[model samples]
Target: MRPIQNGITDAEVVFTNPQLNQWVAPMNGNSRIRKREGTNQNAGGCRLAVDSAGHKLDHIIFQGGEDVAVSEGKHVIDVTNGYLYGNMMLGRMGLEADEGFCDNVADYGTLSTYAVNTTDIKLLYYWRALYTGINRANLLLRSIDNPDVSISQLERNHVKGQALFLRGYFYFLLVNKFGGVPLLLTPSQSSSNDAMQQPRATTKEIYVQVLSDMEQAAGLVKDIRSVESAGRVNKSAVYGVLARVCLYMAGYPLKDVTKYADAASWAKKVIDLNYHKLASSYRQVFINYAQDLYNAEESILEVEFYGNGTGVYNTTGGAVGIVSGIRYFNTAGSYGYSSGFVRPTQWLYDLYETGDLRRDWAIPPYRYVGEVITN
Candidate 1:
């Protein structure tokens, strides 16, 4: 796993592969990496190279393919997986059933005060899930100087931008949910007591880090659609997320009114990019999604899902559709299992303007219609 000490010289790591075939082969397996630095770009740009520190960035990037490629491309493969895992954690946190037909016994218990009991183990589980994402991103950043894996400055910048975005995003979630939290910059490579006993940082400090990371990422990432894989984060998504983060920082607990202008500025940048536009028909978006067709032009960022006939919880499986999909019975063309746990409040349904397409699209006429009906 450690590339620099494996009796491999930096020059051998970078230029020894005359054909540069070793690097391209592993990168080609990962769509995003292939697109970023594939053979087509410079006849073999994906070849791994080392930095001045005798570290091999290529070795770090190669650590993650399916069966694992040569020593060089393994690490790059798992980076995408880390982002996917973080998305799932975000999805889980927003699953509180109080929103409407969804009913979770635990949600009911916690809704009254908008608080969780300290004794509730689920809180710890959720916290750890988010931190796991943070740790993965941190480790990637930590290894940027591994003289064993050879990577160019451009490649390093792109990877660092992504790592920062993910780390900031995880911290944003932590601060919003639990207030002040320990701000661990270095990766916890071991389970030593020193790693576990860090003190909490103020919410302001966390917000500063979040803004700093997002701001840097916005400048470093390329627009995603131009690349082969839209699944990965891009400059536009970074701006969009920055807008939302600014909004969060501006509201309620933080009350940093000045950030209102910052939020607006970031959002305007996304709009100015014109990379995505509103779909003419909202329902078409979901229809396309169910059919495994994604509209990158209209959806700047999307969390992808693959549905099986039966619902299962796994990295590749998504239950949000089932959790919030039409409950009680299945709809022939629907994307979910109709778990019937979450429902919309009638007040919310009625609040929409009569001609607004989203109102009905959001809360359909049929409240529950599969072998059962409840008022």
Candidate 2:
């Protein structure tokens, strides 16, 4: 099979590199049976393709759980690092810096700093990216039971569980952002206007579906201990997210007070599992994130971003530190560079008590002047 190109017409190739090409086998009628390749691999780097025949089906189905996991993994990063990060910057939680007021970050900052309408390009991108994620999950869920797919029942459940969780998670993000959106559960099979247009579901209705998807997912996915990487979602992650979802449902829009109890129940389930605990130090948590270390005990789920934009998989790296981290500049490479697009507000900093270690790590009191650190 030939390596797919960027902006390929027939396939949704998220990432294409030499490393991905080694394991991401293309699906054709001749080779319908395939096994997932590699353990603890970067699933975000996997690519998905649609053959000429399958392209007409309106969705691409992978041959194995690994393929689904790989494709979904990229979506996970897009949602967390892309959409969710934008949400943080837009909200009062993070103040957008002047540097962020230009270029790509400006698209998002404009929505917050100025009066913007639904027609904003950034909003459109966010909507499309999220729905794309939901559609991938939907396709996986629809294809898991096909006999043509060679995955075992166990493998099927694993992927299905992740898909359900992801679909629900995508919808959760959507409902939080847009209040109500057109809810599409099945994979798109037609390009007709009738098939394309969907009425917006009610906020309560969306929450109900989210709850169903996550609750079912919690049962199907593997335990956190069994998962090799924090990048992959497991039972604990599902439970934790479910708890947060319940809390949202119990709040302003829905005002479903009963969900508070549900939230507590889900939160308690994670505690009962005994797999996760607070790290030794508050700084270690963020340090683990910066260093790309997996400490499942504290970090339940994370979007894995690696490399330095130099290797074959140049797209593997993310802007987590560069955008929100401290600003520094030096040509010697002794001090890393950060645009510092988002900074903590004084109110947020003051929320921390004098002795709080998180105060310093989260919102440092110092700045870098050339090669020297200064306060």
Candidate 3:
């Protein structure tokens, strides 16, 4: 299968009609191409196009979806460059400060100082990442059902289910952050279409769509045990996310008290699955993240990062431990380097009771000094 040359351009030009021979120009200002007339020629054309487009669907789900979900990569500028770090890191920083657990350093004081606004570059990055994921999912869903494409019914359901879940999850993130956003469910065939400029859907309407997509996906997707990796969405992950969504609906903004029962019901479904359980220790959860180990029993879903910042796979390294771990500057030492941009506050320290194992691990009382820990 051929790789996608341009994501948006390729997605817009995918045609399934077997009767028209119209010339089409991609939205990216690429050279126009003419489709030859005849049924056989159109079928051959669809097969060729579907092969390349199918590869693109897989690439976006695995690579682009991961970047949007976890916010990895080195270039902290453009979201398409695999530098969607603002999504998770910025949210974490803001939440830590808001919850009175930590304070951001002056050097990285955007969220902590309440300087963030609609025009913030970080917000723009995250917005672009989420929409890009949605667009990719839309393209996949629209193209997967072509009669010329060779795929089994079971495989088609699996792929379609994943696309629906990703689209719903992206919408869920957008609604939580921006309250309301334009909902574009279908693939955009042209930039000139008037329908492309959709008005923002209501908060409750967006949640309803999210619930529908996820509920349908829960039935179509593979079970947690059937999936090969925890990174891929499974029945358990959908159920857990459904629970979270219901709880959100039950809180401020929507404040739909009826959703509380739904949230409990979804949570119970996850528990009744008998597939997942809490880890032996809370510290072990973070340890597994730092070591790139998969604890499927505990982590229902995860964003996967691979390799160090070197060679062809350099861009796959994550900043999980480096940005938030204990302060350290020795590159050759076992502790490695940490910026320690956010530090725990005294209020957070005093909140923890005696003999709390999580207190020391979450808010470390020590620092790394030349390969040694010092209190």
Q: Considering lDDT, where higher is better, how would the candidates rank from best to worst? A: 2, 3, 1
- Where does candidate 2 clash, by residue pair? none
134-184 per-residue lDDT for model 3 (tens digits): 665666677666654454555556656766777788788878877888888
Model 2, position 115: C-alpha lDDT score: 53
Candidate 1 local lDDT, 139-249, one digit each (tens): 556666565544555555666676688778878878988788888887553212333478889999999999998898777666665442344567777898899999998
Candidate closer to the true structure by TM-score (higher is better), 2 or 3? 2
- TM-score for each model: 0.70, 0.74, 0.72
Candidate 3 clashing pairs, residues 3+ apart or interchain: none
Off by over 4 Å in 2: 1-55, 58-108, 189-196, 290-292, 307-316, 330-336, 369-375
Alpha carbon lDDT of residue 304, candidate 3? 39
Candidates in order have lDDT scores of 0.53, 0.56, 0.55
The 10-residue segment with the lowest total lDDT in model 3:
1-10
TM-score of 3: 0.72
Comparing 1 and 2 on TM-score, the stronger one: 2
Poorest 10 consecutive residues by lDDT, candidate 1: 1-10
